[model samples]
Target: MITIIKNKTLKTLALCCALGVNFALSGCGAGDSVQAQSNPSTLATKDLSAFVNTFWYVPQAYTLAYSYSSSTNPKTTAVSDQTIWHFTSANGGYLLGCSFTSTNNGASWTSATIVGSVTANNTVSLGFFGGLVTVGSGILTSSSGQPAFLMQMSSGIASTGLTHWAYMLPITSSDPSWSSLPATNNVSVPTATASGC
Candidate 1:
Protein backbone atom coordinates (compact mmCIF):
# COMPACT_ATOMS: atom_id res chain seq x y z
CA MET A 1 0.00 0.00 0.00
CA ILE A 2 2.86 2.40 0.76
CA THR A 3 4.34 1.74 -2.66
CA ILE A 4 1.06 2.62 -4.40
CA ILE A 5 0.65 5.86 -2.36
CA LYS A 6 4.24 6.85 -3.19
CA ASN A 7 3.63 6.37 -6.87
CA LYS A 8 0.46 8.47 -6.74
CA THR A 9 2.25 11.28 -4.91
CA LEU A 10 5.00 11.38 -7.55
CA LYS A 11 2.41 11.51 -10.31
CA THR A 12 0.63 14.41 -8.63
CA LEU A 13 3.89 16.30 -8.27
CA ALA A 14 4.71 15.81 -11.93
CA LEU A 15 1.28 17.12 -12.96
CA CYS A 16 1.71 20.21 -10.82
CA CYS A 17 5.09 20.98 -12.38
CA ALA A 18 3.67 20.78 -15.86
CA LEU A 19 0.79 23.08 -14.94
CA GLY A 20 3.13 25.68 -13.53
CA VAL A 21 5.24 25.80 -16.64
CA ASN A 22 2.22 26.11 -18.90
CA PHE A 23 0.94 29.08 -16.94
CA ALA A 24 4.24 30.89 -17.16
CA LEU A 25 4.47 30.33 -20.90
CA SER A 26 0.93 31.48 -21.63
CA GLY A 27 0.33 34.96 -23.10
CA CYS A 28 -0.66 37.06 -20.06
CA GLY A 29 0.04 40.79 -19.48
CA ALA A 30 1.31 40.18 -22.99
CA GLY A 31 0.89 43.89 -23.71
CA ASP A 32 3.97 44.34 -25.84
CA SER A 33 5.85 42.17 -23.40
CA VAL A 34 4.60 43.72 -20.17
CA GLN A 35 7.04 41.36 -18.50
CA ALA A 36 10.15 41.72 -20.69
CA GLN A 37 9.87 45.51 -20.58
CA SER A 38 10.76 45.18 -16.91
CA ASN A 39 14.34 45.28 -18.15
CA PRO A 40 15.46 48.93 -18.36
CA SER A 41 17.52 48.45 -21.52
CA THR A 42 14.61 47.78 -23.89
CA LEU A 43 12.63 50.95 -23.28
CA ALA A 44 12.18 53.46 -26.14
CA THR A 45 14.12 56.44 -24.86
CA LYS A 46 14.79 57.97 -28.32
CA ASP A 47 12.51 60.18 -30.42
CA LEU A 48 11.37 57.13 -32.44
CA SER A 49 10.89 59.34 -35.50
CA ALA A 50 14.25 58.53 -37.06
CA PHE A 51 12.74 55.18 -38.02
CA VAL A 52 9.08 56.08 -38.59
CA ASN A 53 7.56 56.35 -42.05
CA THR A 54 3.95 57.36 -42.66
CA PHE A 55 3.41 55.14 -45.66
CA TRP A 56 0.12 54.28 -47.33
CA TYR A 57 0.82 50.58 -47.29
CA VAL A 58 3.28 47.87 -46.30
CA PRO A 59 4.11 46.42 -49.72
CA GLN A 60 3.86 42.64 -50.01
CA ALA A 61 2.82 42.69 -46.38
CA TYR A 62 6.52 42.77 -45.58
CA THR A 63 7.91 43.02 -42.06
CA LEU A 64 8.98 46.42 -40.65
CA ALA A 65 12.06 47.44 -38.62
CA TYR A 66 12.92 50.21 -36.14
CA SER A 67 16.11 51.26 -34.32
CA TYR A 68 16.92 53.60 -31.41
CA SER A 69 20.13 55.47 -30.56
CA SER A 70 20.79 56.49 -26.97
CA SER A 71 23.50 58.89 -28.00
CA THR A 72 24.86 60.47 -31.15
CA ASN A 73 27.33 57.61 -30.75
CA PRO A 74 27.04 54.38 -28.76
CA LYS A 75 29.44 51.41 -28.48
CA THR A 76 27.43 48.85 -26.52
CA THR A 77 23.95 47.33 -26.53
CA ALA A 78 23.60 47.94 -22.81
CA VAL A 79 23.61 51.72 -23.19
CA SER A 80 19.87 51.17 -23.68
CA ASP A 81 19.78 51.59 -27.47
CA GLN A 82 17.64 48.90 -29.15
CA THR A 83 16.35 47.84 -32.59
CA ILE A 84 12.98 46.21 -33.19
CA TRP A 85 11.16 44.66 -36.18
CA HIS A 86 7.41 45.08 -36.79
CA PHE A 87 6.04 41.90 -38.33
CA THR A 88 2.51 41.67 -39.81
CA SER A 89 0.67 38.37 -39.58
CA ALA A 90 -1.97 36.76 -41.79
CA ASN A 91 -4.06 36.52 -38.65
CA GLY A 92 -4.26 40.34 -38.53
CA GLY A 93 -1.84 40.66 -35.61
CA TYR A 94 1.50 42.52 -35.54
CA LEU A 95 4.71 41.58 -33.70
CA LEU A 96 8.45 42.14 -33.33
CA GLY A 97 10.40 39.47 -35.20
CA CYS A 98 13.70 39.84 -33.29
CA SER A 99 15.67 42.23 -31.14
CA PHE A 100 19.01 44.02 -31.78
CA THR A 101 21.08 45.81 -29.16
CA SER A 102 23.78 48.27 -30.13
CA THR A 103 26.35 50.01 -28.05
CA ASN A 104 27.77 51.28 -31.35
CA ASN A 105 24.72 53.26 -32.48
CA GLY A 106 23.88 50.54 -35.00
CA ALA A 107 27.41 50.56 -36.44
CA SER A 108 26.78 46.85 -37.03
CA TRP A 109 23.38 45.25 -36.53
CA THR A 110 22.71 42.00 -34.65
CA SER A 111 19.66 39.75 -34.24
CA ALA A 112 17.21 40.29 -31.37
CA THR A 113 13.40 39.79 -31.44
CA ILE A 114 11.95 41.23 -28.24
CA VAL A 115 8.30 40.22 -28.35
CA GLY A 116 5.55 42.92 -27.83
CA SER A 117 2.46 44.71 -29.15
CA VAL A 118 3.25 47.44 -31.72
CA THR A 119 -0.21 49.04 -32.11
CA ALA A 120 -3.83 48.88 -31.13
CA ASN A 121 -7.42 50.16 -31.71
CA ASN A 122 -10.86 49.60 -30.20
CA THR A 123 -11.30 46.58 -32.43
CA VAL A 124 -7.75 45.24 -32.53
CA SER A 125 -5.18 45.73 -29.80
CA LEU A 126 -1.61 44.49 -30.35
CA GLY A 127 1.92 45.20 -28.99
CA PHE A 128 4.18 44.35 -26.10
CA PHE A 129 5.83 46.57 -23.50
CA GLY A 130 9.62 46.99 -23.01
CA GLY A 131 9.82 47.10 -26.78
CA LEU A 132 12.09 49.72 -28.35
CA VAL A 133 8.76 51.37 -29.15
CA THR A 134 6.81 50.16 -26.16
CA VAL A 135 5.05 53.45 -25.47
CA GLY A 136 4.46 53.73 -29.21
CA SER A 137 1.20 52.26 -30.38
CA GLY A 138 -0.67 52.86 -33.64
CA ILE A 139 -3.49 51.93 -35.94
CA LEU A 140 -2.95 49.82 -39.09
CA THR A 141 -5.95 50.09 -41.40
CA SER A 142 -5.61 48.47 -44.81
CA SER A 143 -7.44 49.62 -47.89
CA SER A 144 -10.42 47.67 -49.08
CA GLY A 145 -9.25 44.87 -51.37
CA GLN A 146 -5.78 46.39 -51.51
CA PRO A 147 -2.56 45.92 -49.62
CA ALA A 148 -2.24 49.70 -49.18
CA PHE A 149 -2.44 50.52 -45.48
CA LEU A 150 -2.23 53.57 -43.25
CA MET A 151 -0.24 53.46 -39.99
CA GLN A 152 -0.70 56.02 -37.21
CA MET A 153 1.03 56.08 -33.84
CA SER A 154 -0.37 57.55 -30.63
CA SER A 155 3.01 57.64 -28.88
CA GLY A 156 6.51 58.03 -30.31
CA ILE A 157 9.69 59.43 -28.85
CA ALA A 158 9.39 62.25 -31.38
CA SER A 159 5.87 62.98 -30.21
CA THR A 160 7.37 63.36 -26.78
CA GLY A 161 9.79 65.94 -28.21
CA LEU A 162 12.99 63.94 -28.66
CA THR A 163 15.48 63.75 -31.53
CA HIS A 164 16.46 60.10 -31.76
CA TRP A 165 13.63 57.81 -32.84
CA ALA A 166 12.35 54.25 -33.02
CA TYR A 167 11.25 54.09 -36.65
CA MET A 168 10.13 51.36 -39.09
CA LEU A 169 11.74 49.49 -42.04
CA PRO A 170 10.60 46.70 -44.30
CA ILE A 171 11.79 43.10 -43.73
CA THR A 172 11.44 39.91 -45.81
CA SER A 173 7.81 38.79 -45.69
CA SER A 174 4.71 39.64 -43.74
CA ASP A 175 5.61 36.33 -42.06
CA PRO A 176 7.73 36.37 -38.84
CA SER A 177 11.31 35.78 -39.94
CA TRP A 178 13.97 36.69 -37.35
CA SER A 179 16.87 37.26 -39.74
CA SER A 180 18.13 40.84 -40.03
CA LEU A 181 16.65 44.23 -41.04
CA PRO A 182 17.98 47.77 -41.28
CA ALA A 183 16.30 51.01 -40.13
CA THR A 184 15.20 53.49 -42.80
CA ASN A 185 14.96 57.26 -43.33
CA ASN A 186 11.92 56.70 -45.52
CA VAL A 187 9.53 57.08 -42.55
CA SER A 188 7.13 59.96 -43.09
CA VAL A 189 4.61 62.02 -41.17
CA PRO A 190 1.00 61.76 -42.27
CA THR A 191 -2.31 63.31 -41.26
CA ALA A 192 -4.01 60.79 -39.02
CA THR A 193 -7.28 60.27 -37.16
CA ALA A 194 -7.33 60.09 -33.39
CA SER A 195 -6.53 56.69 -31.91
CA GLY A 196 -9.70 55.09 -30.53
CA CYS A 197 -7.91 51.93 -29.41
Candidate 2:
Protein backbone atom coordinates (compact mmCIF):
# COMPACT_ATOMS: atom_id res chain seq x y z
CA MET A 1 0.00 0.00 0.00
CA ILE A 2 2.88 2.39 0.72
CA THR A 3 4.47 1.74 -2.67
CA ILE A 4 1.13 2.22 -4.47
CA ILE A 5 0.44 5.52 -2.65
CA LYS A 6 3.93 6.81 -3.51
CA ASN A 7 3.45 6.03 -7.22
CA LYS A 8 0.01 7.80 -7.30
CA THR A 9 1.48 10.95 -5.70
CA LEU A 10 4.32 11.09 -8.31
CA LYS A 11 1.79 10.75 -11.18
CA THR A 12 -0.26 13.62 -9.86
CA LEU A 13 2.82 15.81 -9.60
CA ALA A 14 3.80 15.01 -13.19
CA LEU A 15 0.31 15.81 -14.47
CA CYS A 16 0.30 19.18 -12.73
CA CYS A 17 3.67 20.14 -14.20
CA ALA A 18 2.52 19.24 -17.73
CA LEU A 19 -0.62 21.34 -17.40
CA GLY A 20 1.36 24.32 -16.15
CA VAL A 21 3.76 24.14 -19.09
CA ASN A 22 0.92 23.95 -21.61
CA PHE A 23 -0.79 26.97 -20.11
CA ALA A 24 2.37 29.02 -20.20
CA LEU A 25 3.03 28.16 -23.84
CA SER A 26 -0.57 28.95 -24.78
CA GLY A 27 -0.36 32.32 -23.05
CA CYS A 28 2.79 33.21 -24.98
CA GLY A 29 1.12 32.33 -28.27
CA ALA A 30 -1.86 34.51 -27.44
CA GLY A 31 0.37 37.48 -26.79
CA ASP A 32 2.14 37.04 -30.12
CA SER A 33 -1.16 36.83 -31.99
CA VAL A 34 -2.33 40.10 -30.49
CA GLN A 35 0.88 41.89 -31.41
CA ALA A 36 0.67 40.69 -35.00
CA GLN A 37 -2.87 41.95 -35.35
CA SER A 38 -1.92 45.43 -34.15
CA ASN A 39 0.79 45.90 -36.76
CA PRO A 40 -0.69 46.13 -40.25
CA SER A 41 1.23 44.62 -43.17
CA THR A 42 0.18 47.31 -45.67
CA LEU A 43 0.07 51.10 -45.47
CA ALA A 44 -2.90 53.23 -46.43
CA THR A 45 -2.88 55.59 -49.40
CA LYS A 46 -2.45 59.30 -48.50
CA ASP A 47 -4.11 61.96 -50.60
CA LEU A 48 -3.76 65.77 -50.90
CA SER A 49 -7.21 66.29 -49.40
CA ALA A 50 -5.78 65.08 -46.12
CA PHE A 51 -3.87 68.37 -45.85
CA VAL A 52 -6.72 70.80 -46.11
CA ASN A 53 -6.39 73.95 -43.97
CA THR A 54 -2.71 73.36 -43.36
CA PHE A 55 0.55 75.11 -44.09
CA TRP A 56 3.79 73.24 -44.75
CA TYR A 57 7.32 74.54 -44.89
CA VAL A 58 9.35 73.87 -48.00
CA PRO A 59 13.13 74.03 -47.74
CA GLN A 60 14.75 75.15 -50.95
CA ALA A 61 17.94 73.15 -50.57
CA TYR A 62 16.23 69.77 -50.61
CA THR A 63 12.76 70.55 -51.89
CA LEU A 64 12.82 73.20 -54.63
CA ALA A 65 13.80 72.60 -58.28
CA TYR A 66 12.69 74.50 -61.35
CA SER A 67 13.57 75.15 -65.01
CA TYR A 68 13.17 78.46 -66.68
CA SER A 69 14.12 80.10 -70.01
CA SER A 70 15.27 83.65 -70.35
CA SER A 71 17.36 85.84 -72.64
CA THR A 72 20.40 85.67 -70.33
CA ASN A 73 19.88 82.21 -68.79
CA PRO A 74 17.85 79.83 -70.92
CA LYS A 75 18.49 76.77 -68.76
CA THR A 76 16.38 75.82 -65.74
CA THR A 77 17.82 77.04 -62.45
CA ALA A 78 17.34 75.22 -59.17
CA VAL A 79 17.14 77.71 -56.31
CA SER A 80 17.21 77.05 -52.57
CA ASP A 81 14.78 79.60 -51.22
CA GLN A 82 12.36 79.25 -48.35
CA THR A 83 8.70 78.85 -49.27
CA ILE A 84 5.39 77.79 -47.77
CA TRP A 85 2.66 75.69 -49.31
CA HIS A 86 -0.70 76.49 -47.82
CA PHE A 87 -3.96 74.73 -48.52
CA THR A 88 -7.61 75.45 -47.80
CA SER A 89 -10.83 73.50 -48.28
CA ALA A 90 -13.23 74.97 -50.86
CA ASN A 91 -16.54 74.12 -52.46
CA GLY A 92 -15.27 71.70 -55.10
CA GLY A 93 -11.64 71.15 -54.17
CA TYR A 94 -8.76 72.82 -52.35
CA LEU A 95 -7.21 76.21 -52.89
CA LEU A 96 -3.43 76.00 -52.93
CA GLY A 97 -0.99 78.87 -52.49
CA CYS A 98 2.78 79.23 -52.70
CA SER A 99 4.45 81.97 -50.68
CA PHE A 100 8.09 82.67 -51.28
CA THR A 101 10.56 84.54 -49.13
CA SER A 102 11.88 87.69 -50.71
CA THR A 103 15.41 87.09 -51.90
CA ASN A 104 15.99 90.64 -53.07
CA ASN A 105 15.26 92.05 -49.62
CA GLY A 106 14.42 90.62 -46.21
CA ALA A 107 10.80 91.62 -46.48
CA SER A 108 7.44 89.94 -46.26
CA TRP A 109 6.58 87.16 -48.72
CA THR A 110 4.35 87.45 -51.73
CA SER A 111 1.94 84.59 -52.27
CA ALA A 112 0.51 83.33 -55.52
CA THR A 113 -2.71 81.41 -55.09
CA ILE A 114 -4.68 79.11 -57.34
CA VAL A 115 -7.49 76.60 -57.15
CA GLY A 116 -6.69 72.94 -57.78
CA SER A 117 -8.50 69.66 -58.21
CA VAL A 118 -7.03 66.85 -56.13
CA THR A 119 -7.22 63.20 -57.05
CA ALA A 120 -7.30 60.10 -54.88
CA ASN A 121 -3.63 59.50 -55.72
CA ASN A 122 -2.73 62.99 -54.43
CA THR A 123 -2.26 64.47 -57.88
CA VAL A 124 -3.11 68.19 -58.18
CA SER A 125 -3.81 70.36 -61.20
CA LEU A 126 -3.24 73.97 -60.16
CA GLY A 127 -3.33 76.86 -62.57
CA PHE A 128 -0.27 79.06 -62.80
CA PHE A 129 -0.68 82.83 -62.25
CA GLY A 130 -4.41 82.29 -61.86
CA GLY A 131 -4.72 79.95 -64.88
CA LEU A 132 -3.30 82.50 -67.31
CA VAL A 133 -0.34 80.22 -67.95
CA THR A 134 -0.37 76.48 -67.37
CA VAL A 135 1.86 75.28 -64.51
CA GLY A 136 1.26 71.55 -64.98
CA SER A 137 0.55 68.96 -62.29
CA GLY A 138 1.87 68.19 -58.82
CA ILE A 139 1.66 65.20 -56.49
CA LEU A 140 1.84 64.60 -52.75
CA THR A 141 3.03 61.26 -51.41
CA SER A 142 3.92 59.98 -47.97
CA SER A 143 7.20 58.36 -47.06
CA SER A 144 6.82 54.70 -46.19
CA GLY A 145 9.46 54.51 -43.47
CA GLN A 146 9.15 58.01 -42.05
CA PRO A 147 6.24 60.29 -41.17
CA ALA A 148 6.89 62.87 -43.86
CA PHE A 149 5.08 64.50 -46.74
CA LEU A 150 6.68 64.21 -50.20
CA MET A 151 5.76 66.71 -52.91
CA GLN A 152 6.57 66.54 -56.63
CA MET A 153 5.60 69.33 -59.01
CA SER A 154 6.05 70.03 -62.71
CA SER A 155 5.85 73.44 -64.37
CA GLY A 156 6.08 75.46 -67.61
CA ILE A 157 4.44 75.08 -71.04
CA ALA A 158 3.47 71.61 -72.19
CA SER A 159 6.19 71.42 -74.86
CA THR A 160 8.91 72.50 -72.44
CA GLY A 161 7.46 71.46 -69.13
CA LEU A 162 9.88 70.22 -66.52
CA THR A 163 9.75 68.70 -63.06
CA HIS A 164 9.61 71.83 -60.92
CA TRP A 165 10.16 70.57 -57.43
CA ALA A 166 10.51 67.43 -55.31
CA TYR A 167 10.47 68.05 -51.57
CA MET A 168 10.02 66.30 -48.24
CA LEU A 169 8.09 67.89 -45.38
CA PRO A 170 7.86 66.29 -42.00
CA ILE A 171 4.33 65.68 -40.79
CA THR A 172 5.10 66.34 -37.15
CA SER A 173 7.32 68.86 -35.43
CA SER A 174 8.93 66.07 -33.47
CA ASP A 175 10.97 65.16 -36.52
CA PRO A 176 14.55 66.38 -36.42
CA SER A 177 14.30 68.05 -39.82
CA TRP A 178 11.02 69.77 -39.05
CA SER A 179 12.75 73.11 -38.51
CA SER A 180 14.89 72.90 -41.59
CA LEU A 181 12.50 75.23 -43.34
CA PRO A 182 11.31 78.07 -41.19
CA ALA A 183 8.29 80.18 -41.99
CA THR A 184 9.10 83.87 -41.80
CA ASN A 185 5.97 85.28 -43.41
CA ASN A 186 2.29 84.58 -43.11
CA VAL A 187 0.66 82.87 -46.08
CA SER A 188 -3.05 83.08 -46.71
CA VAL A 189 -5.20 80.70 -48.74
CA PRO A 190 -7.20 82.34 -51.51
CA THR A 191 -10.92 81.97 -51.89
CA ALA A 192 -11.48 80.06 -55.10
CA THR A 193 -14.33 78.30 -56.90
CA ALA A 194 -12.46 75.88 -59.11
CA SER A 195 -14.47 72.93 -60.43
CA GLY A 196 -12.53 69.87 -59.33
CA CYS A 197 -12.09 67.17 -56.71
Candidate 3:
Protein backbone atom coordinates (compact mmCIF):
# COMPACT_ATOMS: atom_id res chain seq x y z
CA MET A 1 0.00 0.00 0.00
CA ILE A 2 2.80 2.44 0.92
CA THR A 3 4.63 1.76 -2.35
CA ILE A 4 1.43 2.25 -4.35
CA ILE A 5 0.64 5.53 -2.59
CA LYS A 6 4.16 6.90 -3.22
CA ASN A 7 3.93 6.04 -6.95
CA LYS A 8 0.56 7.74 -7.26
CA THR A 9 1.85 10.90 -5.55
CA LEU A 10 4.89 11.00 -7.82
CA LYS A 11 2.73 10.60 -10.88
CA THR A 12 0.52 13.51 -9.80
CA LEU A 13 3.53 15.76 -9.27
CA ALA A 14 4.92 14.81 -12.65
CA LEU A 15 1.63 15.58 -14.32
CA CYS A 16 1.52 19.05 -12.73
CA CYS A 17 5.07 19.79 -13.90
CA ALA A 18 4.20 18.79 -17.46
CA LEU A 19 1.16 21.05 -17.41
CA GLY A 20 3.21 23.97 -16.13
CA VAL A 21 5.78 23.56 -18.88
CA ASN A 22 3.09 23.41 -21.55
CA PHE A 23 1.49 26.57 -20.23
CA ALA A 24 4.78 28.44 -20.25
CA LEU A 25 5.59 27.43 -23.80
CA SER A 26 2.10 28.37 -24.97
CA GLY A 27 2.40 31.78 -23.32
CA CYS A 28 5.66 32.47 -25.18
CA GLY A 29 4.06 31.41 -28.44
CA ALA A 30 1.20 33.83 -27.86
CA GLY A 31 3.60 36.68 -27.15
CA ASP A 32 5.38 36.08 -30.44
CA SER A 33 2.10 36.12 -32.31
CA VAL A 34 1.18 39.47 -30.78
CA GLN A 35 4.52 40.97 -31.68
CA ALA A 36 4.15 39.89 -35.30
CA GLN A 37 0.79 41.58 -35.53
CA SER A 38 2.30 44.88 -34.34
CA ASN A 39 4.81 45.20 -37.14
CA PRO A 40 4.82 48.65 -38.86
CA SER A 41 7.03 50.38 -41.39
CA THR A 42 9.37 52.92 -39.85
CA LEU A 43 12.08 55.23 -41.22
CA ALA A 44 14.92 56.67 -39.24
CA THR A 45 15.82 60.38 -39.29
CA LYS A 46 19.11 59.73 -41.07
CA ASP A 47 17.38 58.06 -43.95
CA LEU A 48 15.11 61.07 -44.35
CA SER A 49 18.07 63.47 -44.63
CA ALA A 50 19.73 61.34 -47.26
CA PHE A 51 16.60 61.34 -49.35
CA VAL A 52 16.28 65.14 -49.27
CA ASN A 53 19.90 65.85 -50.22
CA THR A 54 19.50 64.02 -53.50
CA PHE A 55 17.23 66.75 -54.84
CA TRP A 56 18.76 70.00 -56.11
CA TYR A 57 15.84 72.26 -55.26
CA VAL A 58 14.07 71.95 -51.98
CA PRO A 59 11.19 74.23 -52.99
CA GLN A 60 8.70 73.44 -55.76
CA ALA A 61 5.33 74.63 -56.96
CA TYR A 62 2.11 72.96 -58.08
CA THR A 63 -1.55 73.64 -58.76
CA LEU A 64 -4.17 72.21 -56.44
CA ALA A 65 -7.94 71.90 -56.23
CA TYR A 66 -9.33 72.23 -52.76
CA SER A 67 -12.80 71.16 -51.68
CA TYR A 68 -14.58 71.75 -48.43
CA SER A 69 -17.95 71.42 -46.78
CA SER A 70 -20.32 74.34 -46.59
CA SER A 71 -22.37 75.49 -43.61
CA THR A 72 -25.68 74.63 -45.34
CA ASN A 73 -27.26 71.66 -47.14
CA PRO A 74 -25.02 71.36 -50.20
CA LYS A 75 -22.26 69.99 -47.93
CA THR A 76 -19.29 70.47 -50.29
CA THR A 77 -17.61 72.89 -52.65
CA ALA A 78 -14.38 72.74 -54.66
CA VAL A 79 -11.92 75.54 -55.45
CA SER A 80 -9.59 74.92 -58.32
CA ASP A 81 -7.15 77.58 -59.65
CA GLN A 82 -5.08 77.55 -56.50
CA THR A 83 -1.29 77.85 -56.35
CA ILE A 84 0.77 75.87 -53.86
CA TRP A 85 4.40 76.16 -52.90
CA HIS A 86 6.27 73.36 -51.15
CA PHE A 87 9.63 73.14 -49.43
CA THR A 88 11.58 70.12 -48.28
CA SER A 89 14.57 69.69 -46.04
CA ALA A 90 17.55 67.34 -46.27
CA ASN A 91 15.85 64.73 -44.14
CA GLY A 92 12.85 64.19 -46.40
CA GLY A 93 10.71 66.48 -44.34
CA TYR A 94 8.63 69.13 -46.15
CA LEU A 95 6.51 72.25 -45.81
CA LEU A 96 3.77 73.54 -48.09
CA GLY A 97 2.18 76.98 -48.45
CA CYS A 98 -0.88 77.53 -50.55
CA SER A 99 -3.14 80.42 -51.62
CA PHE A 100 -6.33 80.63 -53.65
CA THR A 101 -9.45 82.55 -54.57
CA SER A 102 -12.85 81.41 -53.31
CA THR A 103 -16.39 82.50 -54.06
CA ASN A 104 -19.41 81.69 -51.96
CA ASN A 105 -22.90 83.21 -51.99
CA GLY A 106 -21.66 85.97 -54.37
CA ALA A 107 -18.95 86.97 -51.90
CA SER A 108 -15.49 86.40 -53.28
CA TRP A 109 -12.27 85.89 -51.36
CA THR A 110 -8.87 85.87 -52.99
CA SER A 111 -6.51 84.12 -50.61
CA ALA A 112 -6.18 81.21 -48.22
CA THR A 113 -3.08 79.79 -46.60
CA ILE A 114 -2.35 76.18 -45.82
CA VAL A 115 0.82 75.24 -44.00
CA GLY A 116 2.01 71.75 -43.26
CA SER A 117 4.92 69.34 -43.04
CA VAL A 118 5.42 65.83 -44.32
CA THR A 119 7.47 62.75 -43.74
CA ALA A 120 9.10 60.48 -46.29
CA ASN A 121 6.06 58.24 -46.46
CA ASN A 122 3.79 61.15 -47.47
CA THR A 123 1.97 61.34 -44.17
CA VAL A 124 0.78 64.91 -43.63
CA SER A 125 -0.60 67.03 -40.84
CA LEU A 126 -2.17 70.27 -42.05
CA GLY A 127 -3.65 73.37 -40.49
CA PHE A 128 -5.87 75.91 -42.26
CA PHE A 129 -5.84 79.68 -42.04
CA GLY A 130 -9.47 80.55 -41.37
CA GLY A 131 -9.75 84.21 -40.36
CA LEU A 132 -8.52 86.35 -43.26
CA VAL A 133 -11.12 87.77 -45.66
CA THR A 134 -10.16 87.88 -49.32
CA VAL A 135 -11.36 91.43 -49.84
CA GLY A 136 -10.50 93.07 -46.55
CA SER A 137 -8.77 96.44 -46.75
CA GLY A 138 -7.18 96.36 -43.33
CA ILE A 139 -3.82 94.84 -42.56
CA LEU A 140 -4.59 91.30 -41.51
CA THR A 141 -2.58 89.88 -38.69
CA SER A 142 -3.24 87.25 -36.12
CA SER A 143 -3.09 88.55 -32.58
CA SER A 144 -0.03 86.37 -32.19
CA GLY A 145 1.15 87.04 -35.75
CA GLN A 146 1.39 83.32 -36.42
CA PRO A 147 0.01 81.13 -39.16
CA ALA A 148 -3.64 80.27 -38.77
CA PHE A 149 -3.47 76.73 -40.09
CA LEU A 150 -0.71 74.25 -39.39
CA MET A 151 -0.26 70.71 -40.73
CA GLN A 152 2.25 67.90 -40.63
CA MET A 153 2.75 65.02 -43.02
CA SER A 154 3.60 61.66 -41.60
CA SER A 155 3.29 59.01 -44.34
CA GLY A 156 4.20 58.34 -48.02
CA ILE A 157 7.45 60.27 -47.96
CA ALA A 158 9.51 57.47 -49.44
CA SER A 159 7.39 57.53 -52.59
CA THR A 160 8.21 61.19 -53.38
CA GLY A 161 10.76 61.98 -56.08
CA LEU A 162 11.75 65.00 -58.17
CA THR A 163 8.72 64.86 -60.46
CA HIS A 164 5.89 63.50 -58.39
CA TRP A 165 4.82 63.25 -54.77
CA ALA A 166 2.04 62.04 -52.53
CA TYR A 167 0.88 64.42 -49.83
CA MET A 168 -1.71 64.94 -47.12
CA LEU A 169 -3.39 67.81 -45.35
CA PRO A 170 -5.47 67.81 -42.23
CA ILE A 171 -8.68 69.65 -43.06
CA THR A 172 -10.36 69.24 -39.72
CA SER A 173 -10.08 67.40 -36.48
CA SER A 174 -11.69 64.35 -38.04
CA ASP A 175 -10.75 64.60 -41.72
CA PRO A 176 -7.45 64.63 -43.59
CA SER A 177 -7.17 65.39 -47.31
CA TRP A 178 -4.52 63.99 -49.61
CA SER A 179 -3.17 64.93 -53.04
CA SER A 180 -0.59 64.12 -55.71
CA LEU A 181 1.08 66.66 -57.97
CA PRO A 182 3.88 67.33 -60.42
CA ALA A 183 7.29 68.60 -59.21
CA THR A 184 10.46 69.96 -60.74
CA ASN A 185 13.11 67.57 -59.47
CA ASN A 186 16.28 69.03 -60.84
CA VAL A 187 16.51 72.75 -60.19
CA SER A 188 20.24 72.93 -60.85
CA VAL A 189 19.98 72.02 -64.53
CA PRO A 190 19.43 74.86 -66.99
CA THR A 191 16.41 74.61 -69.29
CA ALA A 192 15.02 76.57 -72.25
CA THR A 193 13.60 80.03 -71.59
CA ALA A 194 10.14 78.79 -72.47
CA SER A 195 10.25 76.50 -69.47
CA GLY A 196 10.75 79.42 -67.11
CA CYS A 197 7.58 80.43 -65.34
Estimate TM-scores for all models: 0.26, 0.45, 0.28
lDDT of 2 at 80: 38
State which candidate, 2 or 3, has the greater TM-score. Answer: 2
Report the lDDT tens digits of candidate 3 across residue range 17-38: 4555323222322112111121
Best by TM-score: 2
Residue 113, candidate 2: alpha-carbon lDDT: 63
Q: Which candidate has the highest lDDT of all? A: 2
> Which regions in candidate 3 have their CA more than 4 angstroms from the true location?
1-32, 36-42, 45-83, 86-92, 101-110, 132-197
lDDT score of residue 4 within candidate 3: 14
Could you tell me the lDDT of residue 92 within candidate 1? 28
Of the two candidates 2 and 3, the one with more favorable lDDT, higher being better, is: 2
Q: Write the per-residue lDDT of candidate 1 for residues 1-197, one digit (tens) a residue.
A: 01111123556545434544322322222121111113345333322232232221233233233333445344122232323343322222334333333324334433333343332231223333333343333433335443322333222364231112332333333423222222222321111111101
lDDT of 3: 0.28
> Which residue pairs overlap in candidate 2's backbone?
67-76
TM-score of 3: 0.28
Q: 1-197, model 2: which lDDT tens digit per residue? A: 01111123556545434555322222322112111122244333334555565555554455445545553355666543444555555444555654333222223443456556655445656654533244446665555564344445555564443354545453344643343333223222121112222
RMSD to native, candidate 1: 18.0
Q: Per-residue lDDT for 59 in model 1?
A: 32
Per-residue lDDT, model 3, residue 163, is: 18
